[model samples]
Target chain A: MEQFDNVSVSKRANVYFDGLCVSYTVTLADGTRKTVGVIQPSKLVFNTGAPEVMELVEGECRVVLPGESEAKTFKGGESFSIPGNSSFNIEVVSALHYVCHYG
Target chain B: MEQFDNVSVSKRANVYFDGLCVSYTVTLADGTRKTVGVIQPSKLVFNTGAPEVMELVEGECRVVLPGESEAKTFKGGESFSIPGNSSFNIEVVSALHYVCHYG
Candidate 1:
């Protein structure tokens, strides 16, 4: 896989995790728009009502939703989700880098 | 409103719309991971079978989904949506800046 380095995400409240596995920002929404680092990989659980927004920044990953046997693959420029408290699994296949905002 | 400049979004496949009203990237996902800039804002219509992923970078905006009377306000670090095929309105209140990858 190719690698890109020394990139900076400009903007007052930009939350990007491409270079580092963490996002950075400061705003009123999402609690000051702070950097939310990756905690751990999770399994996609359907009907859990937990919605999440995943921003694919770099590398590849898989998103598993309900009734979905095969995990949906996504690269660094796409995004999928388990909406509004819907449970799901996010597996970082390669070096995953992306920003995310969850309620 | 405050401004942030000279920020680069690192990563070979990254889509960030800040500094300019355009986002840039290159990858396999979402059609060669191209830069998808903001064209225009539409009304947020809920239950329209359209889902969207919004990456808020800088500035402020509003997203109005159907069944909801008032438009939901989002700042420089938050996002909302009108599902797949769902029509919606995104008003760029104060120099909006963000990234979006849609299908």
Candidate 2:
């Protein structure tokens, strides 16, 4: 996505696997926070407290959230959404590049 | 910068400060490596073994590399280049968003 005005990238952070999965927060002037990250080849599960929109910006991955019977593959320019308080599993076939907007 | 066609965001890595400044490498099909990161407010020095072009994708920072008399402030949409084997100091006034291409 083109850079948005008033969005400031904040201190770096991480999740799940330490250096294998990394990301940074993009905080807007209005206090809205979005995160951008890249996940290396691996399989992992995540539990989230808020709704999230994940946009694939570079590589690709397959994800199967709770209640889903099959994982779906997402490539660059594709996106997926997850409800709040849900969990999901991901299998990284290639390096996965994504920007996640949470609400 | 728009995501390139062949660039793959790889496993996470870091330098200098922990958690405060974070980035991930983008490896290309040709084996070239680039890094994208966001820096929180702080002052830090970095040493590089290869030439680098730092592109500011969001926010701003002031940088004073070796052989430079005064630090230069760079805002979003701007970029600066550094020679190999050099060291540079950065004073982050705001969260700085950048992607570095090295050769």
C-alpha lDDT of residue B58 in model 1: 55
Model 2 residue pairs with clashes: none
**Residue-wise C-alpha lDDT for candidate 1, range B5-102, written one tens digit per residue:** 22223333232221123233323222323222231233322233435566565556776665577867887667665567656656666655555545
Listed models, DockQ each: 0.11, 0.08
Residue-level lDDT tens digits of model 1 in A1-103: 2322222333333322222222333232223232222212333222433455666666676777665877788887786765674566666666555555455
lDDT of 2: 0.72
Error of 2 at A73 (Å): 0.9
Compose the digit string of candidate 2's lDDT tens values, residues A12-100. Answer: 34444644566766655677777777677788887889999988876778899778999999887889999999999988887776788
Best by TM-score: 2
Scored against the true structure, residue A61 in model 2 reaches a CA lDDT of 85
lDDT (CA) per prediction: 0.45, 0.72
Model 2: docking quality category = incorrect
What shift in Å separates residue A56 of candidate 1 from its native position after superposition? 29
